[model samples]
Target: MRLLVVEDDRTLAGLLHKALTQEHHVVDVAHDGREGRELARSGVHDAVILDVMLPSMDGVEIAHQLRAEGIVTPILMLTARDGLPDRLRGFDAGVDDYLSKPFAFEELLARLRAITRRGAPVEDECLVVGNLVLDRRAHEVTRAGRPIDLSLKEYALLEYLMRNPGQALSRTLILERVWEYSFDSFANVVDATIRRLRKAVDEGYEQPLIQTVRGVGYKIKAQ
Candidate 1:
C-alpha cells in the first residue's frame, strides 16, 4: 500500500521512509504540514503518518481540515505531547490513532497496520476480479491460482486498477492517482508500465483482464 508521511524532522522522516520502504510499502514524504495536507488531499494513500508539530499548519489543523473536506483516509498522529487533553484533541481533530514520541519502531509498524486495516470500507484485505486475486495483506498476486511476481509499482498499479474494475480510467487519472503526476506528464512511463503489467498479469491467460479503451485509458475488465 502507498503511504504519506508528514514530518518536519528530517532525520526521523528519513528513518521512517527507509523502514517503511523495506517493509514493501510505497511511501511519499512531505516536510511541512502544507505539503502534507496537499498530498493527503490527493486521495491516494491508504494511510497517513502525521506529526503534530509542523510548519505552516499544525497536524491538528491538517487532520481537522482533511476530515472537514471528507477525506476519510485513516491518520495516525505522532507527537511528544502525551497528555490526556492532547490525546483528546488529536482524536477531536480526526486522528484515528495517536503515537507518543520516542516510540519503538515495532509499535509504530503495528499501529500503522492497524490503522490501515480500517482505512477504507471498499479496500478489502483481498481484491478480486474473476480468478485474478491480489492479496493486500500478503502482498501476493495470483491469476487462476497461479502465482504472479510483480514489482512494487506494478503491484500498486494493478491494485488501483482492480479497485476500479471496468471503469474507463483515463491516462491522466491513472498517472495522477497511481504515479502521482499531473495530466499527460510521464505519458510514456505510464504506457511502459502498463505494457509490463499486461505481460505479467495476462500473458498466458485465455481472457485478458486488463483492457485498453482506445484513446481513453485502461481498466481491469470486470468479470
Candidate 2:
C-alpha cells in the first residue's frame, strides 16, 4: 500500500519511512504541512500517517482542510502530547487513529491495521463475504478455507465492496472514497482494479457477490 507520512521531525520521519518501506509499502515523506496537504490532496495514497506539529500548518489544520474538501482517506495522527484534550482535538479534526511518541513500531502497525479494517464493514479483525474471509491483521484472504493472495489495491477495493454490502456505489463515489481526487487521471484504474478484485473474490464462488449496474457502477450482495 502507498502511504503519506507528514512530519516535521527529520529523524522520526526518516525512521518511519524506512520502517514502512521495509513492510513493502510505498512511503511518501513530507517535512511540512503544506507539502503534506498537497500530496494528500493528490489522492494517490492508501493511508496517511501525520504528525500534529508541522511547519506552515499543523496536522490538525491539515486534517480539517482535507475533511472539509470531502477527502475521507483514513488519517493516523502522531502526537507527543498524550493528554485527553489533545486526543479529543485530533478526533474532532477527523483523525481516525492516534499514537503518541515513544511508541512501539508494532503498536503503530497494529493501530494502522485496526483503523483501516474498521473503515470497512466485516469486522472481527477480518472481512467476511459469504464464505470468503479476509484477515486484515494478517493481510490474508481465503475462500472456502483456501488462501488467495492479492495486491494492496485489490484488497482495498474488495474491502470497500464488502463493507457497503448491498449499496449501489457509483464510479465517482468509489473514486473519491478510494482513490482520493481521481478526476485528473485519464486511466480507468478503478475499473481495472474492480475486474482484478472480482477475479480473486468471485472466480470460484457459487454465487458472485459483486454485481455490475450496467452504466451506473457496482454493488456487493449475498443474494
Q: What TM-scores do the predictions have?
A: 0.87, 0.60
Off by over 4 Å in 2: 1-48, 54-57, 60-122, 184-187
TM-score leader: 1
Error of 1 at 59 (Å): 1.3
- lDDT for each residue of candidate 1 in 97-116, tens digit (9 for 90 to 100): 99999999999999988988
Local accuracy by lDDT, each model: 0.90, 0.81
- CA-RMSD of model 1: 2.5
Off by over 4 Å in 1: 42-44, 117-123, 183-185
Per-residue accuracy of model 2 over 29-59 as CA lDDT, tens digit each? 8898998998899765668999999999999
- Model 1 residue 199 CA deviation in Å: 0.7
Name the top lDDT candidate. Answer: 1
Residue 154 in candidate 2 has what lDDT?
A: 74
Error of 2 at 75 (Å): 7.9
